[model samples]
Target: MAAPDRPAGGGRMLTGVTWAVLLLGLWLWGRDITDGSGGPAPTTGDVAAVGRPIGVRLPPAHAPLRAAVPERVEIPSVGISAPVVPRGLDRGGGIEPPSFDTPQTVGWYDGGTKPGAAGAALLVGHVDTETRPAVFYPLSAAHPGEQVRVVRSDGSVAEFTIDDVQVFTREHFDAQKAYGPRKDGRAELRLITCGGTYDRATREYTANVVVSAYLTGGSGAAA
Candidate 1:
């Protein structure tokens, strides 16, 4: 018997693998990823060749690895209030827990590179907990132009205004579409967490909701 959905399943697997590979490549090329923040200075000729913005790459040793310490995150509609931490990648390639102890503050993936440079600056948090609630619990309900404030350690704050919220099936998550190219030379941010219906058998959510925004204004540091 021919199964109509067999092709769909295969396509989903391929999409998942491709997304995973793109993320891995970004992590491996952290220099190029964060080069947008004036790390490696690209020549005028180089920029002309690409016909797009190219981030300046800095020496690996001197690369700005320090995360932009967030003092607070305010989502008026969702009523979210918490601190942000620098998050790193896990051995399995997924985002590591934002914090080992609190698990309430959001974390930026350290391994992948910082946000606001060239590539996507990924911020992730728990939607909820078994015993108590956590940050990003109400993320799925956020609307466009909502404010997200991130205070850094250098006495500056990065304010982001939400542009859109998108929900993607776990089987069809696309990294390039989610974190790839941007026309403007401005920095971008992405907030991700599990959402959609819960699958008890798999013990996972059916989809992931991503909130993307651009850096509107800030003080202390660049990223």
Candidate 2:
């Protein structure tokens, strides 16, 4: 996503001002931090820790084995239908390229953390195409109480009810709020993507849109 900014030709300085406001908003929200260990390195002890809300102590980095990619993700309100694949960070910690051959994909922060064992499962997608529309194109328009479903390889489906949506500047990516401990400590999911306006010069989006929801029910297995 392009960072928010004024159009190159000028005339929309207000857009730049909005970006400034967003920056301030991010500072207030606190920045996200990547845990050095990607997913929960599950151990036998870690398996017992599962089912708790976010913030439970995760297993060591080498604990749990890597899970398979999700089969499908369905969001009725925004019309998002995509397969989930395991996405990890490149050497630089930026989003690695999507595995096109995968049926559906969701990224795991190989350097920062994993999902399902504990904490919030962080999933992200492109809101639109650089030149053509893509999945999550209607993300900014999603409302609270919407439904998001993820079917894992185990033939179990996890359903989540949208709690709220928030937009934050790239500089202010609040990891804790977006992927950190929650009040209820129940299993939760955080879907993220670029939003706001496009910045042609920066070639990045000005803001990130985060959709938060909690798991309702399913086969009770981790995806």
Candidate 3:
């Protein structure tokens, strides 16, 4: 599910400035999510035509399950299988991402909703490093209707069905649209990574690739 070539840069994959901006958006998203008014409903035109899959029959959302800490996340269609590590906001007030040293790891925002719970669970990873393609390098190629499986610490698997994939440029980012739950009371998941072209002049990715999915089915942990 890899996108076209995205040559890498010499320094960190995602800069602090970018994360700060994203954190600002997420901060507002958190407030909206807690109020049971999930920002705004997503529109097909809200996503780029190329990323929006049309005419695919999506399943009804499964009822949200008990909270469970995610241990790993898998996107079989994109060949992504990575460990989930809990992360918190950094000194800069941005949600910390997995370190560059371990590009294959996915960072989960422990402060937010857990994978199988009643709100949006966030997972972030690097698209590529300076030397090689990272775990989420193929993320942009993932289409709607795909599946994302999260193995939880409670020994249950939470299955989600992809509904949207968007590439939000830094110039025009809507925090609520990118991070808020699409619908209140449903278990939602968001896989995020750097996207768009890498601008050597600015030393940053021009956009972020956000894949949105909702719980469709899952097995509960043994009682």
Candidate 4:
């Protein structure tokens, strides 16, 4: 979640999306955060969007409004199969990704919208580890039309289709665009990681890879 250099202690009020990549580092093999350059991203505590509930999913067809929890994420196209965990902002206000020891898994921003629910849900992982490429190394190559599946708690998989694959540089990062919904009413997902070149001097990557997707249709059976 750190910025370009992601230096600790800058007291800058980065938009919600901006802070996510703003501080998640300390030798990230593949960090997730493009940059923090745009306007404010409405944030209400853990909820990334303002006025959202404790959890907002695209309303269940016949099930209760409260959806199941996310257990794991699978992207067959890129062969990313990893457990999902919850992440939150650190003392510095940057998103806190899972530790380097858990490189095999990804972290979901629990404070934000839950995956498959309404609003934009965020999932972040290391593109690489200190020793090698981590779970999200192939993120940059992700294209539109790919299928992203999220296995949830209530016995269902929330499937989303890729809409856009982009790389946001430190100078051009926008929190709202990165973490907001594509339309006024829809469920969206954001897969993020550090991309481009790594700056040894700054200890952070110059660009961040952001993969955007939206809930289309999914199977009834929950995994």
Better of 1 and 3 by lDDT: 3
State how far residue 45 of model 2 sits from its true place (Å). Answer: 42
> How many clashes show up in model 1?
11
| Residue 137 lDDT in candidate 3 | 81
Worst 10 residues of 1 by lDDT: 38-47
lDDT of each prediction vs. the true structure? 0.52, 0.49, 0.77, 0.61
Candidate 2's error at 215, in angstroms? 0.5
> lDDT by residue for model 3 over 1-223, one digit each (tens)?
4333334344345675555556776666655545645001122333442356568999999999888889999999878999999998767556777998899999998878998798889999887667777888888778789999999998999999999888776666798788888897999999887666666566666667788999999985821
Name the regions of candidate 2 deviating beyond 4 angstroms.
1-69, 97-117, 219-223
Candidate 1 residues 1-223, lDDT tens each? 1111122212121123323543453354444455643001112321111112234321111122234544456666667777777766557654455542564678666655344444457777765444344576577667665676666666666666676566655455456555554434456677765454454344444555667766666656553
Q: Write the per-residue lDDT of candidate 2 for residues 107-211, one digit (tens) a residue.
A: 433333233334456666554333334455556566566777777776667776666666655554554554554644366667765565566665555566667
Give the number of the best model, judged by TM-score. 3
By lDDT: ranked, best first: 3, 4, 1, 2
For every candidate, C-alpha RMSD to the true structure in Å: 12.8, 12.3, 4.7, 11.5
